[model samples]
Target chain A: MEIKAIGCEPLSLKRVGIQDGHTLKVYQDTGGYVQLKKAFGMSPDEIIQHVKDSALRGRGGAGFPTGMKWSFVPKDSPKPKYIVCNADESEPGSFKDRYLLEYDPHALIEGMIIAGWALKASTGYIYFRGEYNYLIHIMDRALAEARDAGLLGKNIFGSGFDMDIHTHTGAGAYICGEETALLSSLEGFRGHPRMKPPFPAVEGLYACPTVVNNVETLTSIPQILEMGGIAWRDLGTEKSGGTKLWSISGHVKKPGVYELPMGYADMEKFIMEDCGGMLRDNKLKAVIPGGSSVYIMNAGQILGKNVTLDYEGIVEAGSMLGTGGMMVMDETVDVVETTKNLSEFYKHESCGWCTPCREGTDWLVKIFNRISVGEGRPEDAQLLLDICDNIEGKSFCPLGDAAAWPVQSAIKQFPDDFKKWLTKKANGNGIEANI
Target chain B: MAAATPTSYTDKVIVSDEVAEFSPEIIAEMNEHLAKYPPERKRSALIPILMLIIQRERGWVDNAGVNFLAKFLDLEVTDIWETATFYSMFNLRPVGRHHIQICKTLSCKIMGEPEITEHICSKLGIHPGETTEDGKFTVSLVECLGSCGTAPMMQIGYDFHEDLTIETVDQILDSLR
Candidate 1:
């Protein structure tokens, strides 16, 4: 089997080994710290401008411009600044960060350094998910090596600037993936998120000027520095630049990580030709174009739109290209039951810091759980919408909105499934009997 | 009426062998976390340390474990249990060796996860929340395992098995066995 390369360029698997964590040797051999040397030569403002010109967007679902985010950090702020890499790969169907952390950890380290330099932050923290215990070992070792090499600590590469990176493991909380909540956890507080607007750039991690970026977002930076902003922009569409790592799973014949150009067309073609088509001859039932946070579209809707795998294309189809976790489902699936399952997750993960999110998520889970088990009420559909509305924008964090969006969108697209559950309940069918 | 010594409370807590093995690692990691905060507020490490202890023991912070952790951190046992149960990560009950956490979230469910879960239950001969007699697998109808794009997914141990089918699940089970 041939090893795949990043950006479709032939890669030396020896550099980024497929094994658990291979960032150290890869950093050593591939002249990894050379970019740091190049970066140290440039002023922090120049580095920020370079990223802005490159039009590199955040890979952590929101697609916010990376450089713009860095510029938000107040220059004269007295607060000890921080740069946090959101390595919490908890988004349903998203596993790209796991690969980057396991395969190219130095890529993340370099990205953090550039971000730190741009934001004028001296400390960086990576909040990885608890499930990734092995990856933490790899990252810890890499950080130690970098420190020993005089790349991370005081006068890194003999430059006057000093920077340090720390890796902190999360205790299986999906909400902690959010920037504010991540900051809270890093500060030794409860992992529950705080409100935005005094966003992380202005007030984060100990109420200091902070910049929180996703793992993929950080990993893409080193390449931008090496190839120049224009070179990277040329690969993707006008708005989205550089190649993205798509972690395609579910129903596909070959389900694994694939590096494709940003604006790759025809979701079906990408799945069928590039990654191999649906497993066996199962007919497509539905597809969650992005991670679980995005709305699910029926297979008919996806195929009808001639869906392309990109940010704009997905948005046009009423779904965001969230973290590129393309989950495909075959026919013989029940939509009501599926929505119930997702609602349950949100309910469980809710930190209970905010009433709307905590209560709304719990209500959504209860309603969907009843519906899936054939005990749904006729008014349950309206109740789900009401709960979503209550939770969205009302909670202290975006996780509430993230949990609510899928349920609201699913009901809008597939009302009949909910109706069926209600009808089944009225017919004296037991909750589990409908299945 | 005299003030009680901190060590007096330690006698009441039962430290199991597994808990003892995990204490050093927990103390070391907790100390590191404590260093991040002001030295006086070392109690900040309580939750994470409890999580670490539970993880090392593979699910559920038992009463003894919680008691031991409380003594270790000089916190009340009730406080640790409250923190442990607040998060979903701590499994209160004994989970099967291969804990099959099926995502029943809205995005996953809409993507046909319910049928997949039903198939899992039928194959395993156990319903959601029920473990197999042989203890090979415990099929828990969990909230999102966070592979939403790959709806109809489950997490077995640390690895996420997405785009699931009865066939895929069976193969996964077989491989694990």
Candidate 2:
């Protein structure tokens, strides 16, 4: 397998593996709050302009430009503007955000101060997912430490800047990771994605101008401010800037989170070299380059085809760089079964906001379930694609498109796997496949 | 995705007018959560308050608890139930002392989750979503818990057990008992 020459350099995860790393003292000792001190010198617009030049994009699935998103928040709004950190990392095959929150809780706080300065927001909320209840205490303690140190409350660093960060726990909705849905959940309402004409910048989080950013994306701000924006931009490609934390899982010998430079890690080398090769030395069958929401790639397309891990490279390979979640599958695994499990996830997590996503996700799960139990029809494949076509753009939110992409790409890349299920024998829940 | 109103997608929840009572300590704890939000936004403390109710009154959100929260937080009963039922972590019914939520997402499924789930169920003498007759354990098949890197995992309460094998499952359950 051919490999890229770029070496590993820990940026966001710099303090993740350190001892007592979540404490404020340990973090401050390692130059944690320096960026917040530095930001006291520059104007909010200057910080936003520096980030725009840095070219840092959202690490969440959308990949929206971070600086541009902050700029979208109205500067002249009378209402209390807010900054929300989307710590609801619920994408299947992704676990990068939890690592940052678990080990280096103060890094996010320092980054939030800088992000808040750029957005001119007073109060910030970290909308943590419910399953991560353990990290809440860690965050609460860190915030208390910062508060006692006079770094978080009024007149922080004696610069007359007042900001407070709070942690809001999500119940358990994957859709809550979406900005609007997250806003609704934060307001103690049902987790549903609202229509996006006004957008969050115009009216969000109690109808105030809000800037929702991903955990890793916001965590990169402190570093971006430390190193000049031009230097940070140089670390990544022209379009996708800065190093990203990639959550690599499934059928790999060593499946852990790796922080690699954008467009630097080749697909073959990522699995073979960085991951210590595939599990049990099995041959690669397929790879979901991003999270399960993105398209799936067959072995031929990923093995030696110069496929990259950045946004442009993965998009060039007909997929997205969603949350940098790479799920690798070996030849022993059944593609149809994997797709069925993923379909069930979307079906269960569907907010039922739009008819297309609510009904279409259930249909996908049912069809895949039938195929798994040897009760599928030959015509079901075409019907599945037809349903995907309806749900992709018809739904109100991206959840529908998230449900459609995996099923459509699974069949598109591995049609024979779905077709062979028609006559295949099933042992209770799954069919034996040699696809 | 559309602007569907709450009435269009109302979830059926068991409602009761019987208000459950809390201890002084627990009420004080709920007050602490209430202190996090602004006085005008008392509804913002609904979730954490309900969580405390779950911890104090049985192991799940019951009709009595929802009614009490409605009075405590000064919100409509439907509002409390809507937020309670939307999240999977909030148990709408009674739960066993220990709730085992096995992640059934793609990554875990690919990494022998079926076997791990089966072993846990068979040993516990119940199926997924069913609590043990002794009320000691409840085995549930849940969605991803964001521990995909260490697949075939289950979360019991706040603790996560990853890289599950049949042997490990047996040991973990035995230690719990």
Candidate 3:
């Protein structure tokens, strides 16, 4: 569902416009794997340098520079290096990676191969979430086609480099989206996130030097090479290079994915115009600019401040541009209840690795459940924030931070709603937590 | 799932000695997945083989299947349970033929998921996480399946049913039977 494609040029999604776009024949005819050849011609150091020059930040959420991440992998290590693609798009509001995987699987394959070549890794794995099992066959077909065309399996483009990519599926743990936890899951363990000093870049899969790139980050590689690094960097804001895809959802008239250059437009204009405005003629009450995990922004904070959907732009507006999965809420949505709903998500997906996250999310959900049912105390908002404070950076991974941010922001922004729900009872028969 | 009964689970470390037998073709498939990782790291293929067992069992991961996998991968039974309970997709208990996993996360919730969940439950005459008497349907309120752009979605079997309304839910259930 490409609702409105407004961008200077397409990077990852360009192949989506062509008929049989996902097929190897059409992808090659339209210059799909050409970047791999270009990347092959360049030295490994040169490719990494090019990516570093492009200022290509991680599209997953953390906005870390991709090339810097690659450079972290120790060169000439005794152990073989590995490239892992974090295709597990499990963030609550994020769905753009699924669209890319379903539409242009080859871009991801090319990116993985190129990353492998740059890092001198011969093996790569694309960790697909178990929910997207339907796409496994499609990806397999794409891989088979690549192999038949000599784009995969041993010497590629006569570069004498051998690389093979495999697809792995996770059952349903959201924490597996975290790189270290992903490596843990890939190694056949519970998806518990490990401590960061031994980051995945240093001692990843099988304890070897590994680089885990997100789906969007890896997919952007082909185009980053296609257009020289600096030229690509100039396409967007001075910092966040190239185009970004925004997954616009919730109470919007045109709720779909839109590819727009980074910092292309402000929140009010993007929501009111590009998204065809709010649904049911309701006034836009709030906007979660980057997935459900980011701070919930009120209309005043976003529209009033003229916020943009870039990494730095969102940070300036007091939130991270996490995954670019924007969830727009209109006047009818109850912020307290919505915040409670998100708490339930955090509670369900917590991997029970650390005490703060495992118990903090559960406590938040319990408190929100009481708040929704009109049992909230006068100090409930403060108490919720207190729990959030414990969970902000105290857990093993960012899931704790993600679980805490929205509740903390909602209380700070909509102080009245938390108290308003304190006096209100939920309407209609609600299902018990049977699952 | 066994996760609910942690006390009894911790008390018992018993894995059934009798393991389920798989056909030669299924074993060959397991071998193919095994070959994906290094020989010493056969545990890396644990997830794929578990998926294969879940498909063969036709509902959930049973002790028999777990025992078989532990033996097949040379892993302890504890290894299988750790993974099984950690992830939401693997069913520790038996499920009906068509399992409906409705997303109850924020994106779907704001988009009328409570109404949709209620409608599905009322029509099926069962609460979430429960299978009907006829053994035809089991409904689970799962977390986000990454379809938030088209919110208020669910997964029945392997297919996603998104942007759901009352009529669509009714038609989907009727067609399932």
Predicted structure with the largest TM-score when compared to the true one: 3
Q: Estimate the lDDT of model 2.
A: 0.85
lDDT (tens digit, per residue) of candidate 3 on A1-435: 454468576666677656778898888888888899889889999899879988889988888999999999988798988999998988887898887888899999999999999999999999999999988778989998988889888799888999888888888888898899999999999998888888888899999999998999999898889888888888887788888888888888888878888887688888898888889989989888898889998888877677876888888988888899999999988898888888998888898879999999999999988877676666677789899999999998899999999998998788767656654435423322210
**How would you encode candidate 2's per-residue C-alpha lDDT over B1-177 as one tens digit per residue?**
753322211322432356778889888878877876668888878876776454446567777677788999899988997888788888866678999999999889989899998889999989998999898999999999998898889999879999888989899999999
lDDT scores for all predictions? 0.73, 0.85, 0.85
TM-score of each: 0.82, 0.94, 0.95
Q: Show where candidate 2 strays beyond 4 Å.
A: A1-6, A423-435, B1-15, B52-56
Give the per-residue Cα lDDT of candidate 1 at A50: 73
User: Candidate 2 on A1-435: residue-level lDDT in tens?
Assistant: 111123556788788878999998899888899989999999998899889998899999899998888888888888888889999999998998888999988999998988877777888999888888888888999999989998898988888888999888888899999999999988888899999879999899888999899999888999999997878988888898889888888999888888888877588988888888988999999999788899988898887888777899999988889987889999998888888888999999999988999999999988887877677766678888899999999999999999999988998899778757854555444433433
Best by DockQ: 3
What is candidate 3's CAPRI-style docking category based on DockQ? medium
Give model 3's TM-score for chain A to 2 decimal places: 0.96
Docking level of model 1: acceptable
What is candidate 1's lDDT per residue for A1-435, written digit by digit as tens?
Answer: 112444456221224444434656646677676777798888888888878877888888878899899888899997778888998888877766776777788878988887787777888888877767678888888888888877788977777788899877676778878888777665545677787778889988767888999988888788888878878767777777777777776677666667777777777777666766766778887777778788888766776467766788888887889888777767656677666666777777788999998988988877776766666766778878888999998887777888888888888777666667776675574343221
Q: What lDDT is reached at residue A203 by model 2?
A: 97
lDDT of model 1, residue A292: 75
* Candidates in order, interface RMSD in Å: 4.1, 2.6, 1.0
Task: Calculate DockQ per candidate and list them.
Answer: 0.28, 0.52, 0.76
Worst 10 residues of 3 chain A by lDDT: A426-435
What count of clashes does model 2 give? 2
